[model samples]
Target: MRNRILILLATIAIYSCQDKQKTEQDNIIKTIAEDTLSKTVAGTADVSDASPTEDKAVELIRKQLNVLLKKDLPAMTKEDRFFYYEAFDLNNDKKNEYFVGFSNSYFCGSGGCSGYILNNDGTLINSFTVTDFPILVTTSSTEKFYDLIFETGGKFHLIKMKNGKYPSNPSVQEIWKGETPKDNAKVLDIDGKKLEKYSF
Candidate 1:
């Protein structure tokens, strides 16, 4: 009788130990699974939070601008520099002309940011200082080129091609006394979506 009782107690102890060991293993696995799930959720959020992917044309333009402004942009970091651009056919030649705005301390001033109008082949048509973005193209044409307009210092300024080139300075340009064009489209608003990061 005594031997049987001892055997029964030993069996119970063994079973209890096995059960505890299995529970611990299960808990470890559950903990690992939970941690992995949390990390995956965080990773997904990171991807969604980033800016929208840019198109191929914009990417190619960035590379071109990098080459065009190589000397002035080599020292600037990716965060401190930006460029805003818009394309339109100013010459009525069916080829689009690009308007590239420089958003950095080196190029900007109290008047406004500096910008450029480039031909379809990335050649500089004109460079401007102290001007606003989204350079409005008027419905009226001058010398077969679209008249450009922008606002600065609470006044609108008109830019017409003179001697085959637009005005290089906006701060001193004559302010437009006429009404703003109703058919113009605002090209580059200064929001996060339109500003492209400057890269070397």
Candidate 2:
């Protein structure tokens, strides 16, 4: 009778450990599923052609934007919280760079609105004080970063990387006299109605 009781106790211990392991496995799978879903939802862009790397870049950029907006404009209304972003490989590197545009009045002016260029890791590469949509990515590059062309005051300006950064203000950049390149990719050209609201 004593030996039987000991065997029963051992069996109960084994079952308890198995149940605990199953619970842990389920929790891990649940966490992974939720994380993937959140990233997918957060990274959904208006343009459906985004690649996997681009989607990851968008998710990182969104997190950075959320932090900035929360810190700078804590009182931002729903309209003020809208932003547009596009991820493109500026160089031949596999990593993609991000272009984010803001329509909030605080970030805009009579000339144009503010735009930002961010590295794949969500570091600020550059910021434009007065810039407009349809930003052109030229076939040519400088400092390993592609040159950008954008219009302001009815003239197209070519922005090049100088001193390890693009010009902070596009209004003062040199005007592009050459014809627009057929292969240039347009960034942040989407309609404002499609802008994604801040996740924060």
Best-performing candidate as measured by TM-score: 2
RMSD of 2: 6.8
* Model 2 Cα shift for residue 33 (angstroms): 18
Task: Write one digit per residue (lDDT tens) for candidate 2, span 18-122.
Answer: 999999999999998888788788975353576786567667877888766666666676667667887789987998788888866977778989878888899
Estimate every model's Cα lDDT from 0 to 1: 0.73, 0.80
Residue range with the least summed lDDT across 10 consecutive positions in model 1:
44-53
Best by lDDT: 2
For residue 47, give model 2's deviation from the true position in Å: 15
Off by over 4 Å in 2: 1-55, 67-71, 192-200
Task: Estimate the TM-score of every prediction.
Answer: 0.64, 0.67
Model 1 Cα lDDT, one tens digit per residue, 1-200: 99999999999999999999999999999998888788788863222232332354456567777776778776777654666677678887988777777766777778887877878777778888777665677887778888878777667888888888898876567788878876786656566345544433
